[model samples]
Target: PLMYPCRFNLSTRSIHELAARKAIRSLEGHDLKDVSEYTDHNSEKYKKMVEWIARDLDVSTLRYQTADDMIKAIGRPKENLCLYCWTGECPKSARPKAAITIDIVEVKPDATRTKEIKVEL
Candidate 1:
């Protein structure tokens, strides 16, 4: 079983999709579970993805976590932490700043037609 701290947030979902397509396909049809405590945990899209992937992987069971339960497990005040990953809401004090951008390019394709990733800084 594997546990995901934040399941429903946009960034989390993007990472999961990337993993499903690239990372976890090698271990296909395996039983796995993702534990989360988001209030929107059971929302339609999130639950559907869970069920679909579980079936694709043949997972035996699926479960989720409640916000209170997660808070208790973390043993910290919500204000002291960045809950953006879980709630998709940035703290009031957080401000946006310029970020470095990088680009990825594939070169020298091989047997599987996959090639080395060239990152442009």
Candidate 2:
């Protein structure tokens, strides 16, 4: 089984609340709605809710593990493991300092021109 622990934030809580409310309403036979009717896929709220659910599900086909359980199974020092998603505490070195750009040139054998590509890091 694959295990990936994660920390839920305000947005996740909000989605859970929304789902809960919908479930409760359906249970009470009041204003029941289909899952597709919850929100438009184009909306930011819908996107966030989907992302939250995916994260909560660990985007995995296998069983899940809790943060503490994963840490214990790893048998490595916590400092060496990246647990930012689970603990929400990122080490200083792991944080990005700034955006970096690199330019690459691609030359074609059949053409006289070269293409330049800009990549951001």
True-structure lDDT of candidate 2: 0.38
List RMSD in Å for every model shown: 13.4, 16.4
Alpha carbon lDDT at 103, candidate 2 = 18
* Residue 96 lDDT, candidate 1, scale 0-100: 35
Worst 10 residues of 2 by lDDT: 1-10
Query: Alpha carbon lDDT of residue 8, candidate 1?
Result: 21
| Cα lDDT, model 1, residue 114 | 18
Per-model CA lDDT versus the true structure: 0.40, 0.38
Tens-digit lDDT track for model 1 on 41-120? 55664555456556766877655554456556655555544454445454433333433221111112252121222222
Q: Score residue 10 of candidate 1 by CA lDDT.
A: 21
